[model samples]
Target chain A: MALDTKDVAKIAHLARLEVAESELAHYATDLSNILTLVEQMDAVDTTGVTPMAHPLHMSQRLRPDAVTEADQRDAFQTNAPATENGLYLVPKVIE
Target chain B: MHDQSIAELAEGLRARRFSSRELTQHFLERIERIDPTLNSYITVSTDVALAAADAADGRIAAGDAGPLTGIPLAHKDIFLTRGIRTSCASRMLDNFIAPFDATVVERLAGTGVVTLGKTNMDEFAMGSSNETSYYGPARNPWDTTRVPGGSSGGSAAAVAGGLCVAATGTDTGGSIRQPAALCGVTGIKPTYGRCSRWGMIAFASSLDQAGVLTRSAEDAALLLQAMAGFDQRDSTSAREMVPDYSAGLGDDLTGLRIGLPAEYFGEGLDAGVEASVRAALAELEKLGATIHDISLPNAPLSVPVYYVVAPAECSSNLARFDGVRYGHRCEAPKDLEDLYKRSRAEGFGDEVKRRIMVGTYALSAGYYDAYYLKAQQLRQLIAGDFRRAFEQVDVIMGPTTPATAFELGAKTDDPVAMYLNDIYTIATNLAGLPGLSVPVAPVNGLPVGLQMIGDTFAEGRLLNVAHRLQQATDWHRAAPADPA
Candidate 1:
């Protein structure tokens, strides 16, 4: 279960973080140690146990499907990095 | 006057000893003088605070005052405050001024409480210490060289330092209780959904809970009374009726069954801390309480399971901050993919990035069942241990932390060591039980916290027990002298 530098790099890439090449070795070591510690969960017998998702044993209430509010597009998107004509702008995907 | 407890301050304001404005200004001045060194506050809204204070004073003049009316309180920067910069101690939200107040903030504001400012915290509540804060680390007011335990460190430090009467804090794993334990203050994390999470910054949604940090358990009780209630807006907000926590503060613990977990008293516990917790337990025994030895067999696996579970949830919770609607975006992005990549890279801190990596890996396609599902299943086992113990005892007593506050950077390099810091506190969060940390003694001249944990929605009983302990000890009154 030892995590390697390449695995660390893959994790960083999946997490959308830019880990420096030099730092990958350190992260690999640190993360591997953490994973080792977490591997202690292997000993516990959770057979026939249904994973508890929420602490409370109640159901969530469902709401009506309705749009009751006005969109404050300008105000909401005021902090956007790139916006044009009441929409978020992104780079062209297709040629 | 500056060091008055929230109860005393409320009474003083009610009795005309001091106006709310005067109290607000006093704290404002203290923040001005001391916060520079402590770095506890990120935004001190003196103008807004004073205005709220003025309004509070008017309410008193008009004979309309409630429990926390006119009281000045700080908030962890994670909560969304209307028109104020609610940075969750990350460059990502550095300039993100929230347009709405968090349900907890809204509830506190409803009580006519004045806002002192937003406190510092670990970025997105990712770290145990406040070092991951983008602005800076919040210095422990007790010993400036040491850390104020985090990510609710600033709230704990400010209350301990007397910069504010009380403040709001959030506990995802052990954020509220752990910091309060280290800083020698009082904090409580109620049943997970007791307080609404509607506007609070999402950490681990299932694990995160909004709580209060203050100098005394009595103060925490009052704040909890205001904050706890059902809100339909937050999907997880409990439908249970909110009890008047302060009304039952004097309930006698004469026949109460207090459980002492043997696992909590075992190795890794500092001798000084063990002595303090034992003395606190002995004091409870003298108060006519019976102590029983209980076992939580799954307790040891809590830390490992929590790291995987919390990080997995955090990874998903933080996915929203990808250079989009609000928060920091990279200056130049060649493409949409580049925008998300560079924005997250530039915005998040190392600890946050590390957690995202851990979480992403745990929740990824191949590893989901082995890591994420396994952790969740283990969470139930840990919780069942508490349920069994509670069936035999009314409440559980233990040291809040295995040791008193350690020096800064002591475990910063070793994340596993840092995660172990919450061994005594994390299990309560996993079980969704109400937990309180009350200062019990001075171990090596540093405060050691005694943790009292009760079953779900039993905050009133929990506070009464902690209140009795505070009455029997002077540890909560100890404060640090001015730093050199």
Candidate 2:
């Protein structure tokens, strides 16, 4: 199925990318071409096929329930774009 | 001395022939002279590296040196390094100095390797070629006009150009092998879980495997032995025991059945590359190895399947980069949606945007089953082909890339054309198998990489075969005529 400008806009929104209205047509076309490639998957028969989460058939490895490394909030957030009071500060979520 | 392998360098360091500080300075001087033209490194931590080298010297003087002591190496920018700018070669993380070392970084630090600096890569490891990197493309050392194969292009270039002894590389769909092949260095991508992905910025987590790019297979063995191990922090880290990769370096390849996939030798493969790989296979035959022409029927479809699976995973992996978090944020946001949109648009590159869009489309409503799920199913078939072929042979042999390193901007405008460069190497990632790219010969002044693929956790065997090939040829040791 061909992706329209509206679909491209929606995907851009979902991805948090601000695609301009003028650029929508380009994304629509480029995304449609990529989708055409992805569309090849439809030809494969996957009935009764269990989706693989990992390549290895082993169970997830578990670790001891303990914090081995000390939380270095001051050290860790030293490079944050905006941090305050040892926490990453973001635009106020609530009005 | 500039072309010494990691093994040779380690031996020299242990024998007091040279101090780690002197070795680190030699590489620093090379980078200062050559890296401006090559653009192989994003950052070179000269002071920190010198300090680390001094510490390594202290260790050797005290007789506590490890196999990698005093050896200088580079890291793909995707791997986090404390107090270092780990940009992943994107403006999104341009100012993002990792607060802590990635598990791989910590592991290597444990082995006493001197980290010269961080190398450039495709932003978040999204592209087949390093052209997508925010820092600009890493030029191939062999032919400066061409690209060094990426997203590990910087690592491969450093080794090939003698900027560093060896460097860490992450492969998601041939990132390690492709560049290694093109740059005429030895690169290996261990099985998916063999190296902990923690702190190695995620890009198609299931497909991403951290490996080493070195001057020789023996150096790769030493690096892999140090990097491969279980990390409880990473849920996918293998709980299995880590093997002594060096011990298996001398393992015989005689009587080993090397499978030549008929599908890999078909149309689109350059005659020059085909001839070089075939010649390398013949050299192995002289070593008592048998070559069996086998078939991986589903191999051709790997490109499409990879585009779907990789993008779908990338779409999810990159979601964390919003205006709200630690990386890049929009200057000012009128609202939440504006924050998200403007931040991403401003932070990411065109290739990254294209992939995120493709990934969103595949995993979007009503298309998940048709595209994402179906692609996963096809990935299984592609993997099954490798398993069936492994039954008939001890290892698989093929060209690392369809052609040698293409010119800069050659395929940049055409995404599909760029994607085709990975056809030979993607199947290994899809199968979670270990693969190595060993330079065989020069074609059109560019080095051709012959890929060696082995079963899961078969890195030792893979390196052994690569080791044998290197011993028989000088291609692995061959450097560019003009190091500058």
> Which structure among the candidates has the greatest DockQ?
1
Q: Residue by residue across B212-308, what tens digits does model 2's lDDT show?
A: 9998889888888888988877888887787888888787778999999999999999999999999998999988899999999888888889998
Q: How many residue pairs clash in each candidate?
A: 0, 0
What is the DockQ for all candidates, taken in turn? 0.73, 0.66
Query: How far off is residue B271 in model 2, in Å?
Result: 0.5
Give the least accurate 10-residue stretch of model 2 chain B, judged by summed lDDT: B475-484
Model 1 regions lying over 4 Å from their true place: none
Task: Quote the positional error of residue B274 for candidate 1 in Å.
Answer: 0.4
Per-residue CA lDDT of model 1 for B1-484, tens digit only, reads 6677877888999999999999999999889889988899999988889999999999988889898999999999999998788999999998888877999999999999999999988889877778889998998888888888888999988988888888899998789988898899999999999999989999898899999998888888889988998997899889889888888988888999999998899999999999988998999998889999999989989999988988899999899987878888887788777888888989998888888888999998899989999999999999999999989999998999988887888988998888898999888888888888888887777778899899999989989998888888778888877554
True contacts kept of 1: 0.70
lDDT (CA) for every model shown? 0.88, 0.88
Error of 1 at B263 (Å): 1.0
